[model samples]
Target: MEDSETHNLKRETIEQQYKTVRERTSNFNSYTSGGSHVMEYGSTSIKAEKIYLYQGFDPASVNFPPNELSHDTQMEAINQRDADILFLWHMYKNSEDGSKKKEILKQISETMRHRIHLDGSIDLIGTVLYGPAKGSVILNTIREPGLPLVDDWQCLKSMVRLFETHCGSLTQYGMKHMRAFANICNSDVSQSAMEEACVAACSSSHDPTQWHPSNHGYSA
Candidate 1:
């Protein structure tokens, strides 16, 4: 009986060690150990160093408050330009190198200027949140202008879909950038279909009526 118990304890310890080893080295494709070695969700085996060096930081971290938000604010801004454009613009502007920042900002400004001509509006809508310690600004694409009263349920639904479609795409873009970085590093990372799907879905959500400088509000 003593011998049996000792053997079982050793078996359990070995099993735990094996699991730990699998988790630590699982990111490399060559480390597979049968069909059961797939990493599970919420697993910590993924290295933050690998992800960060590959993808940089979250867009929100670099861009501030993110371009997508919930509908729990007093005001929301609608703009003719996609929120991701602004996010990218901000990222480029705040990049570490001054010359690179200027180049990116110029590209974004030119793109925005062209979009304003095509759409006839350059309006942006955003919410202001005030607090004692600090304040935050949450911005999102408004489907219309002049703050038409919105149904709460409808707003919630729209926000959900916006997050699911728009913000999700941004996250996928970060992932793609990460994959590109990994490739540069000689890692076997591959591009994702999610990147293409995100672009198509975001483009489809755009409404022409939301164009800036509406004739009713201002003269061309």
Candidate 2:
């Protein structure tokens, strides 16, 4: 026989509860692209159970947004056994606001305890892409510091080469860059012109010019 908790709940009750939570999270959809600020890639990388976007504090107060998961809502989620890992990402224009979001993260961590897995700054990248008033996804994962920084990723061929060569070492952030690069290169345009442009841009971005036709899996 199934466990008592599962046995007790009717099929209808489970479906209704799942529907409610899904509706609540759907508000923060991704931008025009496949995902939001590249963070949406988390759904693929971490096998996210539930993705929530923190859309700033509530209008009535300078805290978590009204639409966001409140203490009660979180407890409800827990009671329903909806999630195993809790992730939080703060997207802020400046360091001060980022600090405030950290406080919220702390609160959630304390309340949820071991269930909480990962939280951190979505970095200035989210702010740059989505503006200040936006929410970032959260999850638990160990991000190795100083992995690498992408200054100008406008170079598609170089990026593709990096993806091909360093596929093993590339982090989530690096993969996002690779996705963005592929998008640009695959856009409707002349292949020669785009490749030349990409090579030029890559050379400009990386000193000593890392772009070569051969390296990019293309024959001159």
Candidate 3:
């Protein structure tokens, strides 16, 4: 019923298979100097890795195998398609006031619009808006870039700055209301309505003098 390789495979644990596979690259190591420029990163990341691999890695002088170009998941070509079209589809379906919907769309940045997806139901709007990279426009703002154990997400910087311009700057306690902010963002409220809500709820809690429009730039 079993040949030697088949018998061995049956007896082998997942840990053994993992170890066997990982041993191929056991000697691999990497090191990086800061970066090519003040705004750029060093050789340890994927884009830099691509460059090094394409040029043939020559750290010291030994030539290792170069990385082949990835041929992952070949599919229909799509160029410059809207990243998400369905974010507003549900809102449009439910709302009767056409002018108000257009006004809301005009106020949101084109970049932020691509992140929303309410495909399932109108009820799931809050959940989908806060999901994964979808939520990054707001949540990623609390931490700064290049900090230890934190991410550098500069894309959604405007949304956070808008928060500060209306709502006061957040403390540890105020940061707890991040979901509430996310909800406001998901809701089809006008920019003026959102600003009014932010100020009404958030302005009085903190000293107004400390929170400045300048601080949102993270230059401090």
Best by TM-score: 3
CA lDDT of every candidate = 0.34, 0.32, 0.37
- TM per candidate: 0.20, 0.25, 0.26
Clashes of each: 6, 6, 0
TM-score of 2: 0.25
Backbone clashes in model 3, listed as residue pairs = none
Give per-residue CA lDDT, model 2, range 1-220, as digits (tens).
0111222222223333344444434323322222223123223432322221212222333232223333233222231232222333332223365667787666545434312210111222223333455412211122357733233344555545543232212222233334344443333334444445434333322322222323434310
What root-mean-square deviation over C-alphas does model 3 reach? 19.4
Instruction: List ranges where model 2 is wrong by over 4 Å.
Output: 1-12, 23-188, 207-220
lDDT, residue 111, model 2: 33
Q: lDDT score, residue 183, model 2?
A: 40
What's model 2's overall lDDT? 0.32
Q: What tens digits encode model 1's per-residue C-alpha lDDT throughout 82-195?
A: 555777777886798888888888767755654443221101101111122221121122324674323343433333233233322212222222221222122211123323
As for lDDT, the candidate ahead, 1 or 2, is 1
